[model samples]
Target: MAEENKSCAFRTSIGGQALIEGILMRGPEQQAIVVRDQEGNLVEKVEALKFIRDRYPILGVPLIRGTVNFLDSMVNGVKALMYSADFYPDEEAAQPSKFEQWLDRKLSSKKLEGAIVTLSVILGVGLSVLLFMVLPTFITGGLLHFFPGFPMWGRNLVEGVLKILIFLLYLIFCSKQKDIYRVFQYHGAEHKTIFCYEAGLPLTVENVRIQPRHHPRCGTSFLFVVIFVSILLSSVVFGIWPITNVWLRTAAHLLLLPLVVGITYEFNRWVGRHVQDNKLAKVLTAPGLWMQNFTTNEPDDGMIEVAIRSLELVLPSEKGKDEW
Candidate 1:
């Protein structure tokens, strides 16, 4: 763990996701997914990279890139998960439901798959927004209803605290799930392997095993920053707008989400660039890193092997091409 804190040889723009008994790594030139089958054999798949920004340069701009990249990541992550899940079907392999059958009949196989992934992304983002943003607003509005004179500042404070509380509870619930526990272990392996790579250590299980599982640029940290930034941004916007209606306030939050996400993305980029040398940047990311305790666990050697191989497959051939 101590070695994980040392200044890295260099950071990489590469990132990864932990899937069902597997790891998905995305690099500059390609992406790789490696899953461990029930038979204990590793299955690997690789795909060439395609960037939406290549055709739509404006989407690559700092603020715009955040929302675009966020959606892109969600879509890709969901697809990777679905791929891994195929290797571990339910014991009974129940037949498709009526709705599924209807959809299969109505849409081509490709279209059906695409529709499912798109719907998954929408539901995932919608749930997050409702849980972290809308719920807090309504809860705060109700709590302060009796106190008509309650200051907006106080109201915002209550909402902010509630948001954090709800988020923590959600993470706690996920960590307690039996199936999710193993995924979290793979999450840890992904981080530790990345740490090893940044430190210029050999990508061996022994080396990754000793590294820290929490990472400053983790998706968990990115989500935390989004919440933190939204709290501050919402407080300012609501203070000026002073929308007393709970529904209106919720609408205002949804409207401002893009801006909040943009700002958070830029802030993370700045911190990622400076975290190695700047004490302030490290301090800023401390909360997110601490939250990893609920989202990651010590992975076994086998998990580390999978993570290492997955990362290696996605690394660019040209030296330094993937450097952060």
Candidate 2:
């Protein structure tokens, strides 16, 4: 834990996502994806990032930027994942369905990539809503019907607990998969490399290996924070309005999700900006840090190399430009 308190001169706004056999790092001005190809060579793709806020100033506002950035990250992440997967396709993987084949033939490569990314983002958001928002409300509402004596607060509590349990179970199941475990290992590598960079250490496998795999600014922590904020917000809303209809309650939760995400993102940013030894920040971030155990795994030296290369490619040209 003492090592966790190691300080550096600056905190960075750079963040990343784990891809199939690769790591995607996004700095303030650029993004890079580095994957280890089957031929045992590192492949890197780097591009300048154009922020939507540059053209649309309104989206740059604090709470509003959170939602915008979250969506942007999702789109970029899906694209990078697709790119990384292309390098190591499984020969035995299932063939595309007739409809998929038809779409592939009808759409050009660029169009197909855009269409796939759009659909992926929609499906991903829908599934999140179904599992975390709708399912919990449905389950808790069913319990309330069967047990009329169940109090309103109890219903909220049950729903919140159910949401968290479902998330944890999902993470556990994903972590157990052979392919996903490798991705989680890359996730750890991404974190460790970022930690090493933040600590003002040289980007080397040995240095990264000793750094903490769990980062306060991780997307995993952002997700856990979202769940927590949703739980609290839902409880307060249900308490005030006392809605009993399950579907209506689910709709309300869905409507509140954007706000929950915004608040959680801001909280994460605040925690990220604080020194690691700050007691209040540590207490606030503890739960998310604890949850990282399922989302990150120790990485091999090869994985660390990929992470290092990715980070190096995306580092801002000017020092302190990425300061939190």
Candidate 3:
């Protein structure tokens, strides 16, 4: 039954992330993030967004779409994260100043949120720069004293390996927390629920439980692909740099991230759509699925219910007329 359902594609094409204590669902037209608060009631926020492609058709093109989508997702993901964090009354969130609130009273909700969105994007970019640029450069620069005169390729290989290792180590560390584990379980639930829908099965807890949590198009899989793509792209770019300074090479890697992410996003899309029928897709994506074992645990029905409710809110009204 599961195998047969896998052949069908008409379901929902939306995707989401399990945030701090909530679920965020992103659809074609609008996105919603739903969180269960301390009062045990669901708090939901919906935002309507226009895709860059809709605004500028050229951005929807192959290579361009990947880059645009990556940035768009990052921006939206942060907003969803902020909304999800609001569920905890004790959570320390940045509140608008009195002056800003006064302005918000006069301005529209859209204007107020637009300011928040801009700030969030700035913070996200700053965080990425610190992690991917500064940290790697510092670590790799320190390594050079012990292994001097290595070729440029060798140094780049070290940096790439360290970056992947650091990323994995961070995941491992975070997965140890009890709250994070529960979030990971919900992450698993999200994947299984989507699988059930795509398989043309009723989106019930029982059916979703039987489906695998590892999805080909998952963020986990995408991250793994990005790491490898970074290694390849960074090596090619780094080859031009002299072997003298690790900081220079690391800086180059950071600068090339958009291209690397763009390529990986396109590759992931291709593999995800073809995985069910193509043997090679399965092979390439196997590591990602395996890695998901560390990231996703079996979720209970309550968690699945939360996922379902979150998904239902974001699905398009005309969803069933054609294949997703």
Question: Where in model 3 is the C-alpha error above 4 Å?
Answer: 1-12, 44-47, 91-116, 240-243, 319-324
lDDT of 2 by residue, 236-303 (tens): 99899988898889889989988998898789888988747589998888888888899999999999
lDDT of 1: 0.92
| lDDT (CA) per prediction | 0.92, 0.89, 0.76
TM-score of 2: 0.96
Q: Against the true structure, candidate 2 has what lDDT?
A: 0.89
Per-model TM-score versus the true fold: 0.98, 0.96, 0.84
The better candidate by lDDT, 1 or 2, is: 1
Q: Which stretches of candidate 2 lie over 4 Å from their true place?
A: 1-5, 94-97
lDDT of 3 by residue, 158-207 (tens): 77787777778767877888878988988988888888878767878888
Segments of candidate 1 deviating more than 4 angstroms: none
Predicted structure with the largest lDDT when compared to the true one: 1
Which of the two, 1 or 3, has more TM-score?
1
Q: Residue 26 of model 3: what lDDT? A: 81
